[model samples]
Every structure is written in C-alpha cells, then in structure tokens.
Target: MSEFLNVNEIKEKVSLLNLLNKLGFAAQKVSGSEHFFLSMLREEYTASLCVNDKLGVWYDHGAAGVSGIKSGSIIDFGLAYWYPASFPEVLKKIVEYAGVPLEKSHDIPAVYAERKTALKSSTYQINSISETITNPAINAYLNMRGIGSVAAGHLYELHYSILDSKNKSRNYFASGWPNENGGWEVRNKYFKGCLGHKGMSFLQGAANRLAVFEGFYDFMSWKVENPKDPASTLILNSLSFLQSAKARAKQFASIEIYFDHDRAGMLGSEEFAADVAGSVDCAFKYEGFKDYNEKLTAGLSASKKSLDKPMIFSAENGFGR
Candidate 1:
C-alpha cells in the first residue's frame, strides 16, 4: 500500500482539525460525511467530532447551509476567514491541524540563553512540521520589536527539524516559554506564550487579588502598567486556556481577567466570570482594546480595581509594556 501523507502534510492541504483547534471549536458528528466547525453553542468538545474511522465522513452539528469536507478542506475555509492573506506557513498549520504525519520537527537552539536579541529569527517550525517560518509576513513579524522583544526575554525559539512544502529537510523556530510543561497560545505573528496556570506565571502575593491577561504581550504590558500594584497575575495566553486555568485559579478569592477584548476574548471572559462569579471576591474586566498590547500601544493607563464600577480596568488614557 502507498504511504499516506502525515498530519502536517494533510494540514497543508486543508484545515480540518487545525481550524477547530485554533478557534477552540468542537466537531459534531454527522451521518454521511465527516465535517466539523467550532460551535460556540456546543456543550462538550470531543463529543462534537464525529470521527468514523470506518467511514471518513465528517459533519459539523452547529454549522448550517453547505456541508461535508475532509479535514484539509475544512482548513481551506478556516484560514480564508480567520487568517485572510494567509501567512506562508499557515497552510502547513492546517496540515498539522488534521493530525497527518509530518516530515520533521524543531527544538530550541543552544546559543539563545546568552543573548539579548535585537533581531528576530526568519521563521519558526515545529518538529514534524511540514513548513518553515520563512513566509515574508512571518519574516516581517519576526522583525517587529514586539515579537523580538519577547524573543530576547523569557520566550525562546525551538529550532526543530521540519519538512517544508517542497518536502526538503529544514528547521523551524517556534516560540515557546522558557519553562517546561508550558503549552502555547500565539497572539500576533512571532509572538508565542503559554496560557495555562502552569509554572510560576501565577506567582502572587498573599492578597487574594489577581490579574488576568490573554497574551504574553499584554501580560508584560500589564506589569508595565501596574508597576506598583503587587498582586498575583495569570496569563491565559489564549482564550482556550482560561477554563482549565480557572479551575486551578479558584484557590484565590479574587481573579481579575485582563484578556484580549476581541470576540474570542470577550467570550472567554464571560465564561471566566461565570466560573468564578460567586466563589471569588471579584472578577474584573479590562476595558482595554481588542488586545492588551494594542490598547497599551494606543496609549492606555494602567490601573487595578476600578472604583467607578465593578471589575472594569480601562486603559483608555494610554498604557505601555
């Protein structure tokens, strides 16, 4: 039998699991064909995906109108809508989405710990990745002081092996937190950070108060803003990490979430509020922009526990990282 392309390869061709994974969407099983969509309405996740290994038919329960696609085709729609302009390596992310086998992967380089990098690596790749971080957009993203700033700090690039679209051997640099057991949640390009309460990101004083942020940039920015507000902080990194992190964070009497203000952030914030509503002394919302970094870039003020109302931390006056 001829060998089939692996998960990374399949993601390049389409975004079945990739799309769902990125959006934190769950797949719903259908009768004939296999297809899935991120359903905000779905109650449970794994249950949503209908993977009939026997018959490759996937269907999404929450989606309406048109129907049916293999994981790859699903990615086609996901990227087209979510990441228009489709960064060069995005298609490969799609392949990784489908769980297909990829040619290679990458790991961190040894030369990093001694440097305060002013420049960014050209691209980042994953071990078993089917693409490289060489996309012009990715290159430019690497150049951004924002992405590079993190690079020079706690985050490092994993210079793992990979197979580019040409199927040639190559290495990719994926951004990862310095600590072990930390998973990832990327914001703007080249900016990778972890969201879980894993590691010491939640180190806080004895006060029950806590600060929550959605991405690394914003988390860094919050510290820049609240230089004097000595409290515990948690960076969900991505909206996806909030739920699990919430369960772990309940130990504190108050948890203030400074998540991104985008649709995803808002959704996660609501869930967070619901999760810790009565249990915690307070659950605050950052009235910042769609994202903390953006709001800080736009010049917002740093503050904690707004006296004007309950849990509204506004960055309207201008803040910085």
Candidate 2:
C-alpha cells in the first residue's frame, strides 16, 4: 500500500528542487550552470540546479557552498510557510491540492500550528503584510499601472513580503497555483506533477485546431488576438510539464505549440513534438515571442497594457520598434 502524505507529512523529505520543478520552475541558467539557483531570479539562462528527482541534491557549476538537502526547509523558508490563517486555510488548501482522501484531513494536527516570529527592527513587517504593501516603493509600482489602491492592497496582502529564497531578504510578490482551473498566474505549489486534473479532452469534430503555450497567461494573449478563430490552448507551465501536455495532445487531430522563442522553450517544444509525432495528427510550432505576457508587455499592438495597469502602452525591452 502506498503511504499517502498529508500537508504535514514531513515536507522536509519532499525534495525542494523536485517540488519546484513540478511547480514549473527550472534552475536559473543566468549563472551559467555555476550554482543550482531557482530560475525565479531575472536572468538569461542557467541549468546549474539540476534535480535528480530521486535524490533532489542540487549542484552548481561554480558556486560551491550549496549542497543538496531535502526540500522541506527550502519550502518552509523559500515560500514563507506559516500557519493556515495567514493565507488560505492551508489544511483545506492542501486537501484540495493533494486529493488524498479528505476524510483523513482532520487527522493531521500540525496544520493548526501557530507561527511565532521575532519582531524586525526595520520599516517592514515580517508577516503581517496587510500593512507593509502600501509603502512608496510598492505604491509607485502600482501607480504607474493605474491599479486601484484597494486591489493593489489585496494583491499585496497575498504577495507583498520580503522572501529570502537564496539567503537575502529580497522583497518579492507572488500569487496562486491554488486550483485545477488554471489562471493567469499561479504559485509553484504542485510537487508530484501538475497540481490539478491532468487529462484534458481534445476538441473533437470539425474543429480539430490546436494551441499550446507555456502557461495560461500566453493562452489569454492568443485568445485576445484571435477571438474568433483561436484554437484550444494548452498550458505547459514548465518544460517538465510538457510531457503531460504531450500525452494530452494525442486526443487532438492536430496540435500547435506556441513555445517561447528562447532556448529552453524551443528545446522543450521540439522534444515534445518529436516524441508525439506518431500520436498527434499534426504538431504545429510558433515561437516568436518571449511569452504572451511578453507580447502584452510589448503592448500587443503598439497600444495595450496589462489590464490592471491603466497605462495603455509600455516600453518593455522587447516592445516598440
């Protein structure tokens, strides 16, 4: 019998890199394979942090001090793991996530554990983020986009914290990965595989068109572009998830992958296409944008901004002629 793990089932043993990989992140390649750092940092590319799914030990090409440890501490510290109330009710959240028999949920006691933190001597609060998000820095970020104070405050409440992922308390923001119905944004939470339902039905009958991208955000961008003739979109959250999406592609008469124009995106898409050539009728390809988000950042049509941001256009690196 397979022993099921609850939210409290010794997460330290849960291999952090493996879990992060499951959640759709890869080793930051910007460091040129020198150290196994999370790809969350804004950089070009780095695969130094390779996950031996079985062992979970990470090594960098150059950065020496980091030895691979089981990911429990990493999850707790990297993701700001506290008691349930701080975020959503984590017990319910985990049960909804793990799907390991909800009846057994009450048996787990640690979910009720209270977190105690030492007060900081700086201008920021450690966890009571409901207050700290309104500072000038955060507000300035919100103001440029014309986000309402209340909505910005809400997003801040969830993501407005200084997370110390690689050691320094860097102020960061994050959100979602909470449900099976994918959204524009989600957190890296799925540990074993895709967090939600794995198998999606192909569009049968005359409409055999296909669409695939790295995630929901890109999917939405395509939808916005071809509202009348957009094909079904697939979410390849990370290259690792591409395998699962490949399996799902079999159901479609034809499939098209809109992977990023970057190296990893092309590699992952091409690999998937090669593997599924026998099953899928047609596996299309398109990689001209960094992502649909990048397309949106590029102002989509020389005149559009992310919806929440009131600015109709932006000057992101790739945007504008």
Candidate-wise lDDT, in order: 0.44, 0.41
lDDT by residue (117-229, candidate 1, tens digit) is: 21112222445322234445544554442344333444444445433445465644554443222333333354333222122245456577777765566666665556568
User: In model 1, which regions exceed 4 Å deviation?
Assistant: 1-153, 172-175, 178-207, 278-288, 300-321
Error of 1 at 54 (Å): 13
- Give candidate 2 regions above 4 Å deviation: 1-45, 51-209, 278-289, 292-321
For residues 72-152, write the lDDT of model 2, one tens digit per residue. 233232322222122224334444433335333333334323221211211122343353454455455433333323232
RMSD of candidates 1 onward, in order = 15.0, 12.3
Q: Which candidate is the best by lDDT?
A: 1
Q: Of the candidates shown, which would achieve the greatest TM-score relative to the real structure?
A: 1
Superposition error at 73 for model 2 (Å): 9.5
Candidate no. 1 TM-score: 0.44
